[model samples]
Target: MTVYKQLLSLPENFSFRINLDYLKSTEDGLFRTDQESITRFIVLDGNLFFIKIYVSNNNRLVIETEDVSQSYTKQFERQIMLYIRDWFDLDIHLEPFYTIAKQDEYLKMPISKFYGLRNIGIPDIFEAFVWAILGQQINLSFASTLKDRFIKNYGKRLIHNGEDYWLFPSPRLIASLSMDELFKIGMSRRKCEYIRGIARLIANNQISREKLVQLSDINLAVKQLTAIKGIGPWTANYVLLRCVRYPNAFPINDVGLHNALKLAGSLDRKPSIDEIKQIASAWEGYESYATFFLWRLVY
Candidate 1:
């Protein structure tokens, strides 16, 4: 390991507390967090590093790593900065979203309640695809449980300070596993096949974040992703929203989105897809953020 320590500055108006609250809302076994810091494993330039991120009393963000040395080039620093920015969605300007949402009925309350909350993203394409597939038709809690099991069984682990930090299984690892191996982890055979197929596509370079990111149009991106087996409109849009950071990606069929809208409108039943679409039309360019804010209502 390279021997050095460093501090990274964050953008102005950053709210570590809000982001930490969102992170702690879910019980993720892969990363460990406390009131003071969040510890997770990150792979940079094929070298795995355990990173601890915390905020100083002066409201500055600090990223601590033990692997900074003469060998760490400017490219590595750029990669690290990009990863941190994407993970926290630091580039999005929320003032316009807030302005648009303030006039809207469905998003007014949620936006107010969860102000400063960014749509935390999954930076890894393979992890995002597998997560979207694993969560199909299942409730969020059980999906999280299955994810914990899958990660612990197939993912790499690093023990730091007597705690294990896990990296989500890579495509190469998943592609090499047999169907029976994944099914043994309590995932259905269909789910297993879907994940394995995605893994094979990724491992072979048939699909990648680089390719997806090249598509400037959100509809084109959705169409490209949906062509893969087991990836439907909802999954495609979900991946686009969470992983690709496409502002217009909207999963109108999402149950959580529907439920949140229903609760927000005080409706007797869940809103139909068309109704949700009509309601969402007001926030055209920032539908992903609106959807994320609504998810916060029920999740």
Candidate 2:
């Protein structure tokens, strides 16, 4: 039972309070949230770690890690920190976003109401893909319910302090699963096959996060990801935005974005695609951040 601890200095313009509130806004079974702390398990380089993070007295992020029955190395510790940094989007500067948003009508409210908020992300590619697939054409509430059931049924877990902490199922495990088993979780047949196909690609080593990240163009990465059966434009853009950290990823046709825009702009009805495109044209390079802030309005 080895433990590792680290204190991270949060970059400027980070509001732990706002980010915590955003995490608390949803009841995803992925992570357990407390009044001031959040805990979840991450598998890095095939080693499992149960990690807990909270704000310290000095406003630094205090990270606590427990290797699941194995000794860990300093290299693994650095990986853990990188994972945490990406999870909270700590390294990116938000001032540029703030500056651009101050003059935009739709972005103004989201930025103000959720000031200091980062685009909290899923750094795990497989997990991000699964989440995007499950969320397709469904409300977030039902998607979360399906995720809880799927994880409990197939994923690895550990009991800590009388509570069960679950890791999202591995690609290999999902790849080995049958259609009937996945169907029992309430996902559509198309979604089931899509997830299995993605799992197979990942488990077979045909696709990887590193490969995508190394691509010279984000568009090429998007093209490759969208080549998968289940990953369309929306899912590809979503995974890229959340996991790969692409600044230009945007899901223009997303209903949530439309609704958030409607609410943000006080429109009598949801904005049309053309209207949204026109409005978002001003936010060319920062579409992902803009969409994230808008989504924060609802969930």
Candidate 3:
């Protein structure tokens, strides 16, 4: 077992509640046992099993890792929590988020139920990019099926406590995979090509999280990613949200988000893309959290 302690200084009303709620529900990849101040993740991958137990309150994060200490496990732990904070805009002051939440009825409705969605992010740019491609235009259940197939086929494993936990496959391993191999795992040809493209970029160190972070402007970064074949606005924004950990990253056209907004607002008609943008604008700094909450509505 390995344990690490760190204190995260977050503004008031910076709740991990919503995040916990998300893990409990949306993570088929892991199991979450919700507790008042601590939530646990049990990850099983083939022959390896690992658990991440997160205890947070009053702006402090305590992580307990058991039966796994590979470099990637540590990397996974660091990246996942960081992604959650970035996804929830926990670094930002709560005043602005609260102001928007209190003032805008749409924002208010979602935040009221923010505790039911998961923040699934892949910090590795290649993995995140590939995941976004795999998920495009598909229902999430099918997406999960695709992910399970991919993981089982390509991912590495750790065995502990009579169980297995898997890590997302490495870029080099994925780059060597043939389209036929991926097709056997239920990946479409287009998605296979996109994954290979991402793998090539990572294997070559051409496009990376470090490089993307230095781009300094979200719009420019989005344009750069979209320049990649098969990468669209949703995929770009999803990468920013998951890989770059951009607080304001919002996949405006996400079917889950659109459906969640319609359900929450009790609208006669689903909000237009423009309307969604307009309503989400107030929560600009906390867009990820707002999106998380809205996505929660579906789960």
Candidate 4:
């Protein structure tokens, strides 16, 4: 019944490139299918700008702009699309698996269907870190409930056309909040300290998005992130996948992934970490893509 507009330019295959499918699985807030979230009812223009969208259950959004200059529209649409997708993670590229992926029956189905599924990408560096941490040892539903409360208490929001859209909290905002504040939302003391420590690092520029990207060696980034109190291999790998666009990144110990693999391949039991590594070996440089494909099997 109403419309809101943002000049979003979507790059070609930006949806596929950014691993939108991956983000949808990992990032709890961004890609919601529930009636309250409008992320699923999305469409794109030639330049990949989110020129039109309609959330089916609660309401509808119609683009009402009359500035219909095709040339200008296309150009600006491209810019806007790219910005939103990158901001929300819609154009990240993961290396391909080549022959190994082609040879694997498990991968063939997913590889073919990947572009059709929503690729997941996380744009917020700090939020990604926090999410990776929060999800460390919990079930997805519980993690989401915690995230809902966490964001509602700490995140900033914008009211557009009487609709509320939330922006994940910034480091500075989070750093200023007391641990007791976060704890009130069901976070354990250890998780609170972990979040605060990460915020302090980001606030002081001791660690930065740019710094992570600048490091060509993924090992170094993982090491640096692990140095933070509660961050470990899974968190670091999750951050790498969502924030830095690292292709080979996969949270090996993840229960969802472990189970998804077993189900996808029709195995009776979960694969050991070493077996998981070997199974993923053929996928090689595209472990992230393979991971994304496998993760899809469960959802």
Per-model lDDT? 0.85, 0.88, 0.68, 0.65
**Model 4 Cα lDDT, one tens digit per residue, 157-193:** 5443454545577789888889888899887899999
Q: Candidate order by TM-score, highest to lowest? A: 2, 1, 3, 4
Q: Between candidates 2 and 4, name the one with more favorable TM-score.
A: 2
Give me the runs in candidate 2 sitting further than 4 Å from their true place.
none
For residues 1-299, what per-residue lDDT tens digits would candidate 3 score against the true structure? 55544455545554556566655555443243445433333333322324344546445655544444344455565665564465444555456565667667766676665523334455457767777888898888888888777877787654544555556777889889888887888878988988988898888998889988788778898899899889999999988987686768889999888888888888887889999878886786778767766776676
Model 4 residue 99 CA deviation in Å: 6.0
Model 2 lDDT tens row, 141-253: 89888888888888877778788877788899999999998999899999999999999999998988888878878789878988888788999999888888888899887
Model 3 TM-score (2 dp) = 0.80
Largest lDDT belongs to which candidate? Answer: 2
TM-score of 4: 0.75
Kindly give the number of clashing pairs for every candidate. 0, 0, 10, 27
Kindly list the per-residue Cα lDDT of model 1 for residues 84-135, writing each as its tens digit.
7898898887788889998889988887788778888988898889889889
Best by TM-score, which number? 2
| Model 1 ranges off by over 4 Å | 1-13, 68-71
Superposing every Cα of model 4 onto the true structure, what RMSD results? 6.9
